[model samples]
Structures are given as structure tokens and as C-alpha cells.
Target: MGVKTYDAVIAGGGLIGGAIAWELARAGLRVAIYDRQEPGHEASWASAGIISPAPEHPGMIPLVPLGKASAGLYPRFIAQIEERSGQRTGYRAQGTLQALFAREAREELSTLVALHHGLGLACDPLHVEEAREMEPALSEELQAAALRPNEACVDNRLLTRAVLEAARRSGVEIFAGTGVEAVWQENGRCAGVITSAGKTAAGNTVIAAGCYSAGIGGAGSYAPVRPARGQMLALRSPALQIERVLWSERIYFVPREDGRVAAGATVEYAGFEKKLTPAGILSLLEAAMELAPAARDAEIVETWCGLRPDSPDHLPILGPTDVEGLLMATGHFRSGILLAPVTAQLVREWIVDQRVSLDVERLSPLRFRDAPNPAS
Candidate 1:
């Protein structure tokens, strides 16, 4: 029999690839995903699931619009995923509270509120008394706090699995253990992938392999992604009863429905090493207990790490590249969970409609070509 071809073949079966495959398959396109291991077991599973669109730093300003758009799309996205996958994503829309503990916390909070207002973002300064009332587990040292009422969180592990299941139900063929070694290029155009099993031809190809994207032979230039290792631990405290997601200058706590508060994450540039160190866990615990003193009594339930895909400028690399039909949707770094819906929508739009709804020119992979490599 002649080789069977698909409409699209994607590398990396994480949130980005799975979402794109589900979207495309729902649009009636033949799609396949090749992952190095079981889907949704990578960064997607290890994420803290904070879905805030607020720029964490000034450098993240460009991502604000996209992040907000995706955050807005989340309710419907979760509803659809739940309906299709028959599983709840543990989506919590209770918003987030950022507490400050420094001596000059009131001044710092004023500056933070001003920054949010200047950026046209929603941020309401909360009296320390009111903040502590809302979350009684908060430390008595909490000098000030602000509420981002629109920020939300989800159980990313469940969401990833639901998306993967939905993709499977939509008839997207998934090759879990099959790693795509390179993009199959022919006559100056994109084709499909060179997988460990062999060649799989398709009309289009996408590299969404997270930190491992650069390892795929023909993808390094367009997706020069490196791994940023983040170590996280989970604490279960039945008596703590922390409701909203809590954020301090050092660490953040995400409370789940199952009585486990997930605290993370030290951003270390350790180059693909997923090892958890004593210092990393200790720092996380110190920050967690500092933010909520009650956490000191909580039981350490779990500890893990994930490698976020970091680009040269710490911005996501998206959209079409020099190759005709090869597209990129990697380098999301910390925002992969937040940007998955928008990224999938943009990728599907590009492949199926030849254009994206959003002005993603700044996120294009071509922008990297003219820029000096940070490592150099």
C-alpha cells in the first residue's frame, strides 16, 4: 500500500500539541502527534496551573494581550474539555491574592497598584486585615496585599489529560513513545517528520516539543529553546484551609480541592537536569511557610520538577518560520499552561485558514533570525 499521509503531524504531545491536534481534528483534518514519551507527563503535568494574565515583569508586557485573551477563553475551553472528555479539570476561578511581607510592603503595594493601573490591568489593594480575613492562614507578618480578581487556576494535570483524551476521541493518532527526530523537508518546503520509527509524511508540521524542541535536527534555528528547571513541592494541610491562590515575592501557593497546597518553584538554569536538590525544596518550604505560617505544620505530600522552555528573550516563539509549511508553537516558558488555548487556536488558524486572528508578528520565529543569540 502507498504511504498514508496526514494533514498535519506534530512533535511533542504536551498541552500545546495536544490542544492543536484536538482543534484540528475537530475541524476535520487528519492529524497525528509523536511524543518521546507518554503525553501530558512533562511540563504540563508539573505546572502549578496559575492562569494569571498579569505580566509578572515589564519584559512580559508583549505577552499581556495574548495572555488575557487566553485567560478569557478558559471558561468555555474548560467546559468543552470537560464535556468531551467526561472529566473535570479542577478549574478554580477564585482569583489570586498577592501578599507582601517586607517592612516597606505598603509602599511596594502602592507601587504595584500604580503599575497595574498604568497598564490598564485590574488590581485592587486590600487592607492587611481584610486580606488575612479572606485567607486566615496568611502570616501575621503580611504587611499588605492586593487582589487580582480575574486571575484563576486549574488542575493542569487533569486539564492536560482531558485535552489528550479529547484529542484521542477526535481521531488524532498519537504515537506516545515515538520521538520525532527532525522535520522532513523536501524541495525547500515542509513535509512531516522523521520519527524514531521512520518517516511520517504530512501536509504540515509543527514543533511544540517544549525544551526539547531544539534537539530535533531541523528545528534548532527556528526554535532555539533551552530548559529552565523549576522545582516544586506540595503540602497537604487539612486544618490550613487556604482558599485563593497565594503569591509572595519569592513563592506562590495554589490550593487544590483535595486539600493539597502546591508550592513552587525555583527557576534555575540547570540545562535539562530534572534533579531535585535539598536547597531547592528548602527554599520553597521557607517561602511557603513565610507566606502562610500554618504551612509549616503541613505534611510534605509530593515533590517534583519541570523544565520550562525558555527562549533567548524569555518570550514565546510562535507562528510560521522560513520553511513553507513548518510552524512553531514552543518557547512558552512559564506561560505554557496559560497560553495553550490561544496557541492552539493560532496554530489551527494558520494551518486551516492561512491567517491568525491575533497580531502575533512579535511572536514569530523569524524575529529570532536577526537578533543576537543571548548565549553568544
Candidate 2:
């Protein structure tokens, strides 16, 4: 009506931003999303879309509730996206198996199994022979496998596409290939963003630029996000059918619907570097081959890299900053894809109505204000 200052203007049109825009638009708010490239071309595309619950490491038990909430929202979330995009998100409800090759490794796997079971999440313990029989691709290695039935995966690329399409369907404006060079502030509030195209728009703005958040002119000081490059390879195996996701000591193998098994990923701390290293590729291939000998037989087809935007604390930075009407939703680290639903819901609630149903104070940007690194 009044030129629509936009109930929200979001940066980084990947899974998190697109999801938030879709929810906000559905709730009848004017929203706009700015992206350096088209949505889902970054880490969201490279992501395996694993929806595993936070692994129980004693002190991190609180994450279970948050993860379960997001997972609970998945059924409805997937349905909404499919209905909007007219395409499946590859939402494979098949469970994930954390296979252990030795009794020594079982100690840790057993703890995870106990934790998931104690939390009342569906999971099963399978004998080595049984697991191999279920997926003949699995090596006849020793020990056991813990299957987390409640956790599953989605094709992040399709899910991301669905979110973007849903947002457009709901009237949210999308500016792809229009990079927001900086956040412009007026007085004490968010004015909007200035893009490389020399165009300016004013409204409430959000910083969700993933690893590139640190490069944003005015917002960089508040964004201490560093790029951790994860290199992965895809293998096409017509003779193999890896029905479920498999996890091991070094890496994980996720099978796709198109007769390809996705093997990944090398976690490297190369700053702003997205190049793949020979060592990284070899390591992934070795780990994957050990778990599924069929991987060696499969033709290696694709190799690429994506940066997992990490914070000093490894937790996401959410909530508004000291600047009124300007929000921070970037530092999600490795769990970005898995945590998209909750991030979107929480951020949308914060922008539209000024509060979230959950108390995300611990994850607030203000929590890091006084820390050694304010960007943390």
C-alpha cells in the first residue's frame, strides 16, 4: 500500500532466508529476499540434507528438544513446499544407520543409541550381519549399526527451490544475482540494503549471507562468520542401491534417487577458499570405499565444494542486534540445512510479531556482544 516498506527484507536467499520469506509471506507480510546468486546454489545445494538429531555429547542434550521440534515440523514443511513448487523435495523418510565397524567404536555409537531411545525417538540396533543383508553394499565389517528411524533426509536443492517458489507464490519479492553490497541504516533503525546494481531499497533487513556475511560492508563488524570449505564427490552406481544413509568414523554416504551415492565431506579451515584439495578427495573416497566396497566400483562423476559458514562457538547467531529492525540470522555453521525450519519460524516470528514461541536468548546475537569476539 504505502510502497510496502516490506515487513522484512532478507539477505542470502538459501534455505534459511527463503524458508523465512515463505513463512512471512504466507502470514500476509510483504517480504523481499536479496541474493548474490540464485537461491540454493551455495552450501544448501552441497548439503546432504541430513536431518539427524543433535548427537548426545552430555552437555548438548538441550539440542534434542530444538532438533525434535524442527523434525516435527518437517512433515508439514515438506508438504507445503511440494504443494507450492509442484515437485518433490526428495523427502526420503527412510531412516539413517550409524554403522560401527568395531567393538571399540560401539561404545560411542551405543551411547548415541541409548540417548535417542531415552529421548523416546524411534531407533533400532542392528547386528552386523543384519545390516549388511539389509544393504548388501555395506561391507561385511564387524560390530553393529544403530538406526535412527525418526531422522531422515531431503534433497536440499529441491527443498530450497520449493521454498523460493513458495515465497514468490505468496508475493515475496526475490532479487537474484542482485548482490546486496551493504546494509544502509537511517538514524538508529534499519533503512534497507544497497546492492551492486546501485539500487537501494528501504525496509526491515536481515543478514543471512552465509560465509559472505563477513564481506558485507556495514554488517561485517557484527558478522564474524568464517568460511569452512567442505569438499565432496558424487558416485553413480547403477549396480548398487544404497537405500539408506550411512555414517562412520570419517565420513558419511548418502544415496540419491537418481542412482548416485553422495559421499562427503572434508572439513577444512581454509578461509574464503572453496577449492577442492586432492587429499580431501582421496580421504572421502577411502572412507566411503571402506564402508561400501561397491563405492569403488561406482563411477566417480561429480566433485565440488561449499563453504559451511562457522562461528567461533559453533552455534548459530539469531535475533536482532543493537540496531533496531536489523536482524542477524547467518552463523548457523554445519547445521544450516538441518536447522532451516526452526530458523525460518523463529526469525519470521521475531520480525512479524517481535517474539518467538521459543526463548532463543541463548542463541541471540546480543549473547556475543560482550564476548571476546562480538562477531562470535
Cα lDDT tens digits, model 1, 172-250, are 9999999999899999998889999889989989999998998997888888889999999999886678888999999
Best by lDDT: 1
Clash totals, every prediction:
0, 0
TM-score of each: 0.97, 0.93
Estimate, for each residue in 1-376, the C-alpha lDDT of model 2 and write its tens digit: 2333667788889888898888888888788888998877998888878887655355445556667888888989999889987878888878888777766866866776777788767778887778887788888774778777778888888888888988898898998998988887778777887787664554568899998886776676666788889999989876567888888877788878787788888888887768988899999999988888888888998998999887766677787888888888887777787778998888878877788898677777776554454333
- Give residue 33's lDDT in candidate 2 (0 to 100): 89
Q: Looking at candidate 2, what is the lDDT of residue 4?
A: 35
Least accurate 10 contiguous residues by lDDT in model 1: 367-376
Spell out the clash pairs found in candidate 1: none
For candidate 1, the per-residue lDDT at 334 reads: 94
Candidate 1, residue 277: lDDT: 100
